[model samples]
Target: MSTGVSTSTDKIIVDKSRGHRNKAVSKAVRQTRERLQSGHASSSAFDRDVLQMYVTAVLQGAAIMPLFVIIVAALGTYFAEDASLLFWALLTLTCHTANILLARHARTKEITAEAARRWRNLLLAGQFLIGCCWAVFALQDCAACEPSSFTLYKGATLLIALSVTTMSNFMLTPAVLVGFAPAVVALAARSGLSRDILELSLAGVFTVTVVFFNYISDRLFQFSLKILSFQSEKDDLIAELEVAKSMSDEARRRAEEANLAKSRFLASMSHELRTPLNAILGFSEVMSAEVMGPLANPTYKEYAGDIHRSGQHLLDLINEILDLSRIEAGKYELSEEAVSLLDITEDCIGMVQLRARAKNITIHDQVERQLPAIWADEKSMRQVVLNLLSNAVKFTPQGGEINVKVGWTAGGGQYISIRDNGPGIPEDEIPVVLSAFGQGSIAIKSAEQGTGLGLPIVQAILAKHDGQFILKSRLREGTEVIAILPAKRVLQSIPAVEQARPVAKKRRSFA
Candidate 1:
């Protein structure tokens, strides 16, 4: 029974050992494959980036190598036989010079797949040759040296070689191995030749250290490759973003050019178009009034009146188009002056009153009394008031009421609001109504269709004055349009005490 238990325990231990061995083998194989792949992979942009980095490291190391060589030569002269000092110094200098030339050459060349492989191989070869130089120094006998002095010299040389190679060439794992393998083998062989337990143990420890360094180098290479890949992707994304921004800028410039061209075309044709239009209106009016002679048929006078009205409407549309074009082209220069808002509002109301009366629409004017005058363009302000009133009159049904108010805003700005209780615009269609040549469904189906320029022109003019225009409407309820002039445009009044006093005696003297 005891034997059976022991057998079972042994089997279990064997199974665990086998599993561990398999795992170690798998790990080793994976690491080997990775190293091989990294060494022989075809060059891409990323590979070039890695090569560039490697060259930079080499250049930096080249600078330090000469200093190291000088220090080692000094030490050898001071502590031991100086016989081989010149030979070692010359070899070190030559190796460093060669490495510098190679690194610079690699930097100058545009790396391709085949070229990259060749460069890497050359770099590895250079490193190996340099390692052999150090190895030759380390392997040389120092019979004149004391035991402690010899130990110190050997240890220093080996440490320097390992550290330099490990740090400078770690980004390329294969390069690290090739560069330091000779030095490590030479040191191990030298240590073993002593046949002392401590020396052999030291050699074993160094071998382990070399393996550790190689492992670290491999990991570092992978990490550096990942970082470079991420940087490349980031560069690509930045390039694409720059391209998109340039295209958007170009499109914007083209659109502006097209708009300018349309404005120029319209401006050029204005005089020619208005000349015929004025003639048509003038002749139609004279015939309708029968000022020269009586018409042969009474119907002829009515036809002339219709022709005159149509011509007038066409003239108004043309004028609206021209004004809108000028505004869009940034050519509408404001002629600034002190103007009374109340006066302008009254004039606009008078102009639209006849039309409002035809529809039986009631216009309620609620203007503030003794309102301050504003610094603004007189003609533009008049047009703004007129456009708002006309829109109200046009949209309001018979017997519907419109409220027009001119008052001070909360911000001390002056505002004119015109509201109509008629078939208001749909909320979704408000933007359409405000755009140039845009009309809502309700406005389209109405008895009268405007040129759709009134609101847009008003909005543009307000914007030019650094003011704001707001339109609010709801379907089947009402619509309100407000034009606000900023407080900065409000002209301050003189003090009452500053007024000139009347002369009381002037009237008596005249009598």
Candidate 2:
């Protein structure tokens, strides 16, 4: 199997089972939530909410309806001749009382979707009984008054009742219809049999009024339904957000634990691994130098030199890994002091100068005069500079050029820039190279491969000092890495105040 040069840290897991069990579970949860919000015929949450609104409205208006009927009956005793009007008012009040008790009881019960139907029917039945009382009220002729006047009186009372019911019970469409439709039909039937033209006209007008208000009531019902739907949708969205938050928290906890475990393992094994590495380096160096005596076989001497170089390379890789792990674990503390960027850069260049000379690479150093010392970790800064310079020397082709610069930043800070005219990193692969152990295609194919920790270490060190790290590169153009220390980190030296020595004359004047 041939592996690709570029790599990613993501992991993909595939699970194939009978119905994709995980998806099935999620789908079930979604469908159940939707059903609870939308179901109407059954006792769903929507039905229960609407029913609760209806019950509450009826209970609130319970006393008003009785007060109205008693006042109208008292007025009838003076205006009309019918003694039966008092009895009708009493009966209507009784029906109102029954409905109020029923509504109050329903309000106290837990009405779910399953029981919403039963509760609604009971409420509608109570309302239909009230409509029967209104039907009886429509029959009173008020024989003591003029025929036309009585007709107007009857029509006006019915209109008021229709308006009241439509307002109080509009949430339930059936309640409105059963509460008032019987009275409209009764008045129409009574006026037709009497064959009175004036009475018939008033009755027709009353019917139209009832129809118009019912239409308005329907619009109210739709609007209320829309409001309820919006409310249900809001509740579901809040639930989903809560679930997502919990899942995110869980995943974060797991990631932190795994990272902690990795740090512990690396820390514990560091000493054990380095001890053997030191022994290997010592033995290989002794053999390569032949310090005890000269080797008889030339092939043996060549092998010893290879062993020494390989051991040194392994030691370097081990050190880089441990440094990166410590940085990630937040255990790498900065021993901060005032350090000069020019001095550090110059020293790093010297350290890599022999390697660059072996490859015929020219390094040009540019320094801004009078650069300020920055408060930062000295050892970490040296590591950052050396890693960048080493990379430049390793990648720059024979006789290529590298430019190094140290200068004051525009924001009264300091920066170190290292640029190499080698095979530049592909723009898309810059992130890959910056990640831990993430080598780009160029690095993977290079003759001198690296552990891919150089830039990451440099970035981490700069971050510890509250500085910035920027890497810019293009395909075959060049690569430049800038490490910037903020203005706050630049230790600006204070000018000492110059003052002449105070003369002793003040003491003589006091004496």
Candidate 3:
């Protein structure tokens, strides 16, 4: 117990010493939780990761982008018979291909948080270059077709291109605006030059549509960021929980090892301690009794008697420590047999009777007769009875009453209960008193004190027998302790077998 206690204490001290590490982990977790709760989960630290995803997305749809550009140009050239549309298509394809090459190169390179802004600026620049190609396309006049129809066709082409850019490049925050805003501005400018009302209205509607798509793109990016943040938080929580579990397991294992070492040390040293102790007791007893010769001085005999009593006390303490250690170490093996619970309780009462008489304490015992013997260790039962009786005697005031009971339990088990009208323990200190080497306020104030292993040993012994030990106490009222044996341990009387006499004569007469 000492070694285990020390080890736990040391671990606590070490944990305190390294509390900074725990605080840092807690801080990160706290910040993450705050961000989520405050609806600010889109951390700037994840920008690099988002950019990486954006680069991959743009490169994936690279072939399709150039195809759309060529198709739009070809459609316009068919309707308008314009060579300018062809040149515009060629220029757009070149710009779109360059953008693909840039994104692919960025993907191959290591993208770090520090380099994220640089890469982002570079990609936005490429988008603006492609937007320039769209601006040039917006200006191509359709001379071979009706003016209104060509305007419609041109408007449709620009809208389609803007829609495609928005839906695909929404992962990047400014991509939709950078790639299409230039074209929208060019259309507005062309409408202003024409000085027509419908053209101005069309230009205004195009600007509004562009703004709406950009807003939608930003919202989608936010939604994706929120989902990623949640995933990252979950992963961190699980990892921390695993680490905590591992630390707990390690601490438990180390504590067990320390307890084992303590038990082993105590077991090995018990004999080394008791051998000299035995000689001291023997010699002191002889001197106190004056077996060989009478003592010259009364004080000398008194000193010898004191020595004997002190040695006995030391022996008792050692025995209690060893018993508790064995029980805690799971090494206490019970010697089982049929023992009369009633008989054992009576004997222990008698043993403590003289001490009760010394204090003028009256003991009232109630015994239920016709009780069967129970399957238990006789020595353990005796020890259990004695410990309860001894505790009753120690706490009982002079002229106080002690009640000892042996009876059948409600569940058909055997129970021995000892109650004393003494200064009872406080409700809070009951647990403390029940622990090893713990004492209550009453015990601390009294002349009588013990190693405090008595109740614990009794509890452990009952547990081994598959029984139960209960202590009930109230402040300034009284205390009662009950030790119960389960019904399985109750040995019932076996009925005798009746023998058949002269059975052969009856069998001969039977059909």
Candidate 4:
């Protein structure tokens, strides 16, 4: 029983020992893998960790290369006097070559992502080369040094340290960060833990932070500028669209107004042509009646005369229509000549006297004895006066007065005026009456027959003469129409050839 128990205990102990050994082997394997990875990540030329490692290496190499060289020389002196100078010369050459390599790689390039990365790679390679050379020198020096004595740099080590400082400081931060990291790490490790290493580490951290911040700021500013430019272009397009819309609206309004004017003109012209035809037809039917006897019946003879007169009146209306149409179509021009204003006014009144007498209205003429001759178309001016007198006689009530006045106005113009006691026009409706085919509001409600083209003709005629028509009217009191024209003397090349003649001496006269 004792042997069995002892065998079981031995078996258990052996199994436990094997398990412990396995774990120990596993841990050792893991540690070795971790060390290899760390070494490569930190010291490899292409690795990001090289920046820290390289900077450490540089400071440490600088602080201790002087001591290492001294120790190597001392050992050489003790073993072989001639060999010390040979080794020293070889060390100097190696240090200078590494520095030159570093300097050659650290040049400015175009700023871009790919270029920045390439810069980092180049700097790292340069730093790694420099560090490796210094490491080899340090190892060799330490190998020859005494255990108890401290070593300092010789002339060769001093040169290496100075060259590295120049390269690291002169290179831009992005390049320097990648190149100087390995040097810094090595320097920290080998420099006996000095304050100089701490200062250098802080400097490294600050430089890298500033460089990254500046790069980010530049990118943000570029993005903002692009956004502002796009917005400005958008605003300009919107303004152009608004202007186009406004122009389109204005053109549409003008087209509509032109169409409306065309429709109104057509309607008025149709009415004018039909009105004269009705009178012609009515008068012709009456004249054709022979029931009252043709040769000797006075009543029948008067009826025939009335028919003839009506036919002539219709012909006159037709002729006026043609004249108005020609003027409106921009074809009529004034045949200017010296005209007698007094004679024109008297003829107009004589023509409309029968119509005024039928309404029992009184006609009065007020003329300065002899008026100055005016520059006007004699026939057109006579028609203007006749139209005014006829209109006054038509509207005036029985026993009401129609007054005709003609003279040279005090304000340097010739004027012919017709005044009547009649229902007058409203202020707001006056302007509309002056328009073609437009008439007064009162005319719309009355039994009066008008073609609505009279005033338009009057206005057209005055415009051709370069003259003005003035209307003064008050509701229920009276109305006055004035035709003002530039005096004819202004156009005369001869100074009133008959100025002293008795015919021209008087200021006003009758026809």
**Can you tell me which runs of candidate 3 are displaced by over 4 Å?**
1-42, 492-511
- Clashes in each model (backbone N, CA, C under 3 Å)? 0, 3, 0, 40
Select the stronger candidate by TM-score from 1 and 3: 3
lDDT of 4 at 484: 81
Q: Which lDDT tens digits does candidate 1 get at residues 154-239?
A: 66666666777778888655776676678678778877787755446545765677677788888888888777766655654565
Taken over the whole model, the C-alpha lDDT of each candidate is: 0.80, 0.83, 0.85, 0.59
TM-score of 2: 0.87
Model 4 lDDT, full chain set: 0.59
Best-fitting candidate, scored by TM-score: 2
Sorting all predicted structures by lDDT, with the top scorer first, yields 3, 2, 1, 4
Query: Which ranges of candidate 4 are over 4 A from the true structure?
Result: 1-320, 488-511
lDDT string for model 3 (248-274, tens) is 776676678578667757865787778
Model 1: lDDT of residue 497: 81
Which candidate comes out best when scored by lDDT?
3
For candidate 2, lDDT tens digit of each residue in 1-511? 2222122321211112223543554665576477556643222446888899999888878888898898878877778967788999999999999989999999899997799989989998999999999999888877679988877877788888888889999888767678887888888899889989977887788888878888888889888887887776676667766656655665566577578556655765676677888888898788879998889998888998888888889889889999999988898999989989889999899999999999999999989979878888899999999988888888788999999999988989899999998888998898898888888888779747778888899889999889999999887877898999999999888999999898876555554
Global fold similarity of model 1 (TM-score):
0.77
Question: In model 2, how many backbone clashes occur?
Answer: 3
The segments of candidate 1 whose C-alpha lies over 4 angstroms from its true place after superposition are 1-44, 49-113, 135-149, 170-173, 187-195, 211-253, 496-511
After best superposition, candidate 2 residue 31: deviation in angstroms?
5.2
